[model samples]
Target: MATTLKNRSWRLSAAALLLSFSAQAQAPEAAATPAGMSGQEMLFWVLVSLLGVLVLALVLTGILIVVQLRPQLRKVYEMPTVRPSWSGKVLGLFVGDPVLLQGRVRDEIMSGHDYDGIHEFDNDLPPWWKMGFYGTIAFAAVYLFYFHVADAGQLSQAEYETEMKQAALLVSVGSDDPNKLTDFQPLTAAADIGAGKSLFATNCAPCHGAAAEGKVGPNLTDEYWLHGGEVNHVYKTVKFGVQGKGMVAWKGKLSSKQILQVSSYILTLQGSKPANAKEPQGEKDPTATKIAMR
Candidate 1:
């Protein structure tokens, strides 16, 4: 191949010399033709010359690479070949080699158990997984300390109670609770009586008559009562109505303040005469008399 290349070089040099001589000989003729030829014809010849020069350069480049660079490529295949393990073949792209990718490794971390004569190594957990596990433990500790020990946040039960109290507060806006059965008091303002009158007209006027005059129920005036006529007693009676006496319970239907207002309005009717008042039915009370006088 070397002898052939030497001969080819000589032949190519001779051909180039011949081609240059022919070009010199034709130059005068081509120049005279261009004077007669059109502009497109001249341009076509110029482009053909450029393409021929480019093809020659490419051929020379390929021959130089084959002669010089191919020997270095031959040395690569001659170097010592390492028959890397399967894992090394893949992992060596990024890392050099895995620790126990093949036969038993014998440095330090070998364990006792051998599966069919294969040894095991005690490698620690991956750093990232270990860190995540430890982080979870730390988070749990902080949560426990803050909520239960330090009291920085409410626990489930405490949070529930707080929410319930807030709900009760919202439900009780603009009114007092009527659920406490025995914590009764009297309210005597005109606003209280007027509100009570409105409630009574809706609730009790059918049975007791408008203006507390007698009807199906006894009159509410003239200081007489079934149960009792004291303000607190009246409040209780209205809250927990006479069950068998045809009056339904109002505690379930009214607020504590509403019951107070109704009782107050009834007390104001003590001596006001109404037509066809029902005869008084319950015992007279010393407490009632004292309160009425006051």
Candidate 2:
């Protein structure tokens, strides 16, 4: 009886230690992020710790199995007729009392009048099932305390807001209002023009031909102002397109710097005069000619 108690105590201790390690692994620590560890590094460390814990649990389980089976094997060696049942002596440790392990023993049947020729047995529920039920209750209480009572974890809405704030930090939001125009000059850098050429090919080249020769749109090469040909004027025109004209507004679609880039790029095509160019639609801008001469 003392040996049985000692073995059971050892099993309980191992379980407690396993639970402690699992709880430590699951609990969130706020200090790691400020310490400059990247998310991937933290996850890698967490996975390594979990793997170590798993290996330790397996070792503890093997130790417990050996401890429980040793005495039973010794008893079998001592007497052949009094040999211990493998199911009762070995597997019974996990399922509870030896008699209860393989369901109702004959002695457990209630000594009462049978109903419909069938006798009922008064048997306790399996220990493993009861333990699992109790575990679920304990887990529910802890989860409720951690998330609601103690407020240790963020709720769904709080997590979403945190993610949005983090995303905002990574992006730069320019306060330049599209309605409020700027007197910005067209970019003259070769790199800026090169980027503008790529952007134009991808976005603007479909409507305004590959060479800005105007397929469905007005010719961009001529000294005519469909919207205004000066850099700032062209910037405004691109930023906010003409209403009732097939020109689509690019305010939200393109960034302010990108609009300026494409506008400056368009201005560079003023004198190319490519073939199959559409007729000039708007009046000539003398201001644009004056700016161009300078």
In terms of lDDT, the best-performing candidate is: 2
| C-alpha positional error of residue 134 in candidate 1 after TM-score superposition, expressed in Å | 82
- Please give, for residues 166-193, the per-residue lDDT of candidate 2 as tens digits: 8777654543444445688878787777
Count steric clashes of candidate 2.
0
* TM-score, cand. 2: 0.38
Model 1 lDDT on a 0 to 1 scale = 0.68
- List of clashing residue pairs for candidate 2: none
lDDT of 1 by residue, 1-294 (tens): 667756666666566556755765676654555457878897688667756755685577456645554555444433445223444334332333333333333345466667887767665555456668899999999999998799899888988999988878766443234433354556656677789889888888898889888799888876667777777777777877777888778876898788888787777777778888888877775455322312
Q: Give the number of the best model, judged by TM-score.
A: 2
Residues forming the 10-long window of minimal summed lDDT in candidate 1: 91-100
In order, the Cα lDDT scores of the candidates are 0.68, 0.73
Against the true structure, what is each candidate's TM-score?
0.37, 0.38
Off by over 4 Å in 2: 1-180, 289-294
The positional error of residue 36 in candidate 2, measured at the CA in angstroms, is 50
